[model samples]
Target chain A: MNKAAASNIYDILDDLPLDSGQVLTGAQIAYETYGELAADRSNAVLICHALTGDQYVASNHPITGKPGWWERMVGPGKPIDTDCHHVICANVIGSCMGSTGPASEASDGAAYAMRFPVITIRDMVRGLMALLDGLKIERLHTVVGGSMGGMQALSLAANWPERAERVLVIASTARHSAQNIAFHEVGRQAIMADPAWADGDYYASGASPDNGLAVARMAAHITYLSEEGLTEKFGRRLQNRKSKSFGFDADFQVESYLRYQGSGFTQRFDANSYLYITRAMDYFDLAEEHGGKLANAFHGTSARFCLVSFDTDWLYPTAESRHIVHALNAAGAKVSFVELSAPNGHDSFLLEHEQLDRVVQGFVE
Target chain B: MNKAAASNIYDILDDLPLDSGQVLTGAQIAYETYGELAADRSNAVLICHALTGDQYVASNHPITGKPGWWERMVGPGKPIDTDCHHVICANVIGSCMGSTGPASEASDGAAYAMRFPVITIRDMVRGLMALLDGLKIERLHTVVGGSMGGMQALSLAANWPERAERVLVIASTARHSAQNIAFHEVGRQAIMADPAWADGDYYASGASPDNGLAVARMAAHITYLSEEGLTEKFGRRLQNRKSKSFGFDADFQVESYLRYQGSGFTQRFDANSYLYITRAMDYFDLAEEHGGKLANAFHGTSARFCLVSFDTDWLYPTAESRHIVHALNAAGAKVSFVELSAPNGHDSFLLEHEQLDRVVQGFVE
Candidate 1:
């Protein structure tokens, strides 16, 4: 664990300033970098991860070895091409990665678990900014992300406007809508229902809260895809044979698929981190930060803004993007918005949608 | 639990033989009679119940002591007016209600659990037919139900066209889609996850798969409502909170609502019945029984069909009703379909909807 010792991102990211007048006294952060900054350091871009995403934005995740989550548009020749933009992706503050979150150790060498300060999106952005400062990138060319990542971008534009020149958000909203927060709450409850969760202190436990975590993931996973996508990909097709079993088992392929997704996720993610990240998102209310005027959050913002929404993404629908456009217009900020048609629901921003790709490419380039 | 059931106006039923070749040993059917039957039994109307509903269509539930689920739509002067029609509702064969199902004891004086023969919607209709035969009632009037109840209605009309003069199906489909089966699979998994499920044999020991059952109900309940409904009623709004606590609690009101729904459901409903009923619904395939031709199910049918769908009902969906309508049309059967706007989603059929009331009234009248 010490081989990377001094170079550990966690050591570098500990002790972040928090909103509750307390410093984040935990571990370091995990991150990845792409492209190169100009002499003015004005070309650096910070990409934030959403729930279940991390520092592997444009590279393979170390543990899972899967392609970086946003690899489709964040590579050297992609939309937020590293060749043109010095991009940086950091795992959020309250995440399972090398971030100072619930899974990390406390000063007393115990897993933080519930002891970690409940973090907000603002807190995450603050930590990211600290990382930027460490990298000597005073101002960024742009900040971009989708879903929770978009929340971070929105947070940055509102709380720290001078940190970027442009901000692009996709498949996200300025605040967690009641339904969105409700979904997260269900997921959290599912995780807690597992006996192994043990009040979020499962580090020394004999087993992981994998079942609860799986249920939580399955519930949230439904919101990530459109009914149309599910139907088209896996309709009432049986998992094995054409005959019905007439028993309580996964008969359809979709059921098995959802189960697999949920179960597989437990291996790489932490249940406590799931609770923390979701709470952070639910607590994110730009209007509240601006004293109840949503527009006020972006008032006097110099960052050029672009927002993208998917037509079928019910989780964070286009209406949510429109609301942001209305607020940005009210704030008189330079902003662009587009709602692209895609069947992937809130996941379209991370999938292949030529129009979305074009819009993001045009906006970021 | 043994009680003499009443005779009904729509008691013109036949205990049609089961296609599976298994005689339901020790069969006991529970049902309710509403209104007065005409001398010729021409006003007899059969009402089916959804997944968790029962034969007490107008009476009070013995467990929750709540009014019959469809009470608002039925009764003396409601849409399915008892004054003009003889309403007969039978507990489905695979349900917990008095009808023969897994919850019923086996010859050994033990709960059937997984031992009960896997039944289908048609099997349920067949059992109702048997109950009707025992009463010596000849049908004329109509058949009706929503969700799974609707499936039974369609099954009745398709398998025994000459029996029901009119079939009124609301928020239903001809066959359970793959997605439907998938959701049910998730639910069954949730129930099985509980240690107390004890391989679905917890009944004799006075143990219940409460946690697993609750999670199942929570997930299914979400499907019964629309996203718009969730957002409008409980959007990101915290349960009695001005801000989030940054922990994994039911921060949003909707989460609390779901938890309440899940936990409260365990108190009255049998977990095994949930599995059995959902499985029966999923196994339903009207076309499969008639040479893979949906139209063939209604071939030479004398029954007039009315299908009512709620626009927001993603569970059964308007498209599902449309498919059935198209099938009936192909068979040259008299059919009427109306897609009504309702925010309640699949459960909308059971709620207050003027159009739904008008549609059922006009069709049955």
Candidate 2:
């Protein structure tokens, strides 16, 4: 996309709703579309990302050399079948990328900084709805995501039940468990603790709080895998030597992996976006929207739901997905639940697996 | 109890072997003795510690304003009652406390720093042998520990099977899992990345890697507890606030908890010590020391072994304890295994619980 087209999303900000008790207004959301929109826009599929993922779900990251976060499941001829489905992957509000968030210009044209209103997951979905309106999409064929993205899929199904005919949530929970919120809190604190974070006014600060962000990533990365996975992959082996020099060094392979994860994450991600996104995720509670009853969220909703969970994903776990399934069943909503066997934990949804691919393709189609 | 008597242990180190082949041995090992050493030293009980735990297992931490790490399970009226068993809790080798570790002085009377050797669980046991000889403790009633300390207990039994009559391994594994090592590596890199580390010679420069050490502790601390424990203690609830500031601050209770844990840890703990201890833990592998035969680690052992694991402890779960139990059973050893219910995860052994307490009390008795 050219800078003019990308910047067009910024210029049209005034057309979108800025306030509804949401912490921020004039929020900019960035997105990308793949495949052609079918006549009537009925073939459109919306893809939501996890806390750190953005609109580049099927493309190479501009800064990092790593592949798109969800390329395994969203590429052409892949699960979501770009050949048959018009896929839309949008950067959620309160995130960096091309999206308008705390780092984006306010009405007066200054970066929102700490002044950005805290956006909720529902607010993000609202922003996405506006984006869809801008794209002239009346209704989506499906809404799909894993982890935090999965949460969004459910939120879209609950708050705007008619937006999609099918909703596929992978490795996600309907509500942010107290444990989930606690872990996210640790990551946010790590980023904020960076001497350079400058109270979320980091854009003009030149250098970001890379160290804190790195630590936060390292901490979150641990929650994304199973203990068995860690054992099989990097069991306490030394780094580049047989003997330890005994000083502060990456003595074990696991420590080295975490450091690499943390350090590499700083390249493409924004610290403020991280803080904002995590807060939004933490504040998300679908059950709270429907008289504190989870089943009520799906009450009378015609959207067909498919919730996928990896057996090893203790962070969200199969149980959390089952909770959603149980709620859906209680509401008598059409939904299918599968606990896919995967050793990769919560990250399993992002990786390439024949079973996961088959499941996503069948569900979305 | 007096300083003069404690200083005598330092003089005896000269008679011990110095550094050789991946082991550090140029300094003294700090320790505490409870109950009287019976005649012939037949009642001696050697207690070990986890990665960060020190010889102050049943004493006060000088900096944190807290009691010993395992005081709940080791003091008077506790499970490992000092009123009955003669307990010897020693700071392991590769530790900062008076232990002969990398942080210890070399023969040149300067901190070994990076020159400290890569020491293993067996090597730590070897250092203990020297301490035992100096104290003239010929035989033991039991050897006990949780996590890393448990590894040392197992190592003692494996290396000198006849010396220990009973062994209690709690929340531990015989081998380092890949994930375990990976987490440690992340922490080490966090410390090393700090300019204050000064290539691990921060000791001479008087500018220690406090930030790195704090970050490392923050990461490792998360693994030491179960999600249930963290959620129970610190949920998404903000610290004395009803709403998030949307800035880089302690917006949630967990962030404040982690920050406190990180900053408070830097006070008494040395950065180099954190590096050395974690490295030792990473090098620990019972089977590797016994000519690659995992069962050989306990070959011909007559010691009664009890391995206790917590169901929520992913770090070293019941499966890991069962792995050790299977090997012990295969070796024709008297071994019992118990999978306890605890919300504390890997750190359950240190918590005040009748289940773990009863197991240790009965096994030791």
Candidate 3:
């Protein structure tokens, strides 16, 4: 488990086919790994990330200079114990962090930007499959992800059934709901409305649609946490003042927090990547791809499925997880579904939870 | 009861004091009335509008060329029946529809724009009070409103308890929670981030921040409807297409509907007014103005209170209504609370509902 050796980037020169009827050539995928691949390659676990997450799963994020997003659950003695399992986390295609995305350079040495092909959840999974192929990993011990990551796990399980033995999807859905598409559309519009976006070619101008991206992040961030969580964390409490500002400044703690989150995100993420990734998420519909019957997506799957949902995660409610479980059941797949109690909303998957830890540990073992 | 005479503007030359310690001079309020005012003024019912709603009430909106937002429940024989009682609806101050707002001209013959004073829900209610004074109304038989309008009703009953005989607040809260403020902050950020906003002075340039405002509307519109409503109405339906376009165009029906709502809003609504009104809603806290005790706000008020909430209205859930009812009960006030079943979310108040119609009829009677 050498940290330096575990984290690296791989170049896939093969022309990757896209759902948009285009091909992505000379694509690069940034990834990080923990522990060591067992001789039989039977102990490798692939962990997919959420919309704003990257390949820094169990390690320090190079850009943010902070611990990985899921550091609490995926370190040395953590539930995703690196000591017992070799964990592979990749920055999905259509993302900013060193992966082949809108910000990535094209074969002609230009940033793909708007020229990047529209990708789907299945396309992202295909990228992961390519990375797996390069690493010569025959199969994954477990494919685990939450939120968008859950979508990727579900996509991998459905499209490449033999790629994984166990599929653990947490706080995710088989398809994007109307409300989901609506919110993502809002984010995309916000980004595109920015003049600085310059039709996604801002890299040459040294300016980014930071303001628009910030607003988009702010909107998306609200959906990640529950109302109760926000109420408890910030409420209508004033920020650095005794009374209301009665102006446009961030007066409330929640406003300040959201502003900070929004601005802070622009520094580390690309706005065009935000557009591309969100579009992929919006286009996710495993059931539609499999003939409008969710069960058909898993018609010949041999993977055991584990679905977890937080009771307060309104973004991907327990009902969504239940829907996936129903599909697995109809497909005659071995599956376990649980609606865990968590006040943190859709972000419960990344937060510390003893029960979730126990479940992840037991399932992975 | 002449439609032409009922819809008109009232100008108050006197300086209107605001909660921000600022004054708004030469303020104008646009209003509409249904039916004839009783000689004794005992049959007058003040109907407040939510954010984005205007004084059109039971008549046609001059701009949108559509029926009044709540026409379904405010007609001759409908709930809040014009035949039995005179109804007054006013576009609150800081709004655009013929009202004194950011879009209104200042004393120096320039648009107030960002120079307009930041207002609160209380400030809006104060303007209504001025309108009532101009009309020579002593006491309204009922002060009724939903959403932001509910905040106005609560403000009126709390600050000027003797002005109304009854108060009906629907799907609203006594205060804006952290989540509420967060959403408003997102919308504001979206509007302000648009380069076309040009620091709220886009009017003279003939280029408005329609794109930014549209995004704001889209985001806010999502909160107005329930997930169930969205799913039922649109689901994963495409917009006049057989399958996904695999591009960023409005691929989903929900996206198309939201885009239409957003763009259509720009033609009739002022973006700066949206910023001001949402700010007012964000600043709403009845208890804060009432010495931190919610019950104190209703102290000695003779107005019978009626609070209605829809079960699916997550924006302002039943719990918020229950909180207000508890305060009324503690104040020894006559209060009726009901959480009705509706899949329409917070916008249920403006939609057709027989139960809501009956409730309004019984309460007004």
Q: Write the per-residue lDDT of candidate 2 for residues B1-365, one digit (tens) a residue.
A: 01111312443445444234443435576788777766667778899887777777777765565798878877676777777777888777667666666666788887777777666677678778778877887778899988988898898899888788999999998887887776776677667656687877777776677777777877788888888888788755688787666455676787788778888877767787677677677767778767877788888899999999999997887888999999998899999999999888887888878888888889987
Q: Model 2, which residues run further than 4 Å from truth?
A: A1-11, A15-26, A64-67, A75-77, A105-112, A198-206, A235-256, B1-9, B15-26, B75-78, B100-110, B201-208, B234-238, B243-248
RMSD of each: 3.0, 3.5, 2.8
TM-scores for the candidates = 0.94, 0.90, 0.97
lDDT of 1 by residue, B1-365 (tens): 11223423233233335556665666667788888988777898888989988888788877777888888888888888999888888888767766767777788988788788877788888788877767666675888888888888888888887788999998988887766776677677777777778887887676788888888888888888888888888876778888665566676788889899999888767888888888888788889889999999999998888988989998988998999999999999999889999887888887888988889889888
Lowest-scoring 10 consecutive residues by lDDT in candidate 3 chain B? Answer: B1-10
- Could you tell me how far off, in angstroms, the CA of residue B205 lies in candidate 1 after the best superposition? 3.3
lDDT of 2 at A242: 85
What DockQ class does candidate 1 belong to?
Answer: medium
Local distance difference test scores for all models: 0.81, 0.78, 0.90
Regions more than 4 Å wrong, model 3: A1-7, B1-7
Candidate 3 has what TM-score?
0.97
Q: A327 in model 3: Cα distance from truth in Å?
A: 1.5
**How accurately is candidate 3 docked according to DockQ?**
0.87
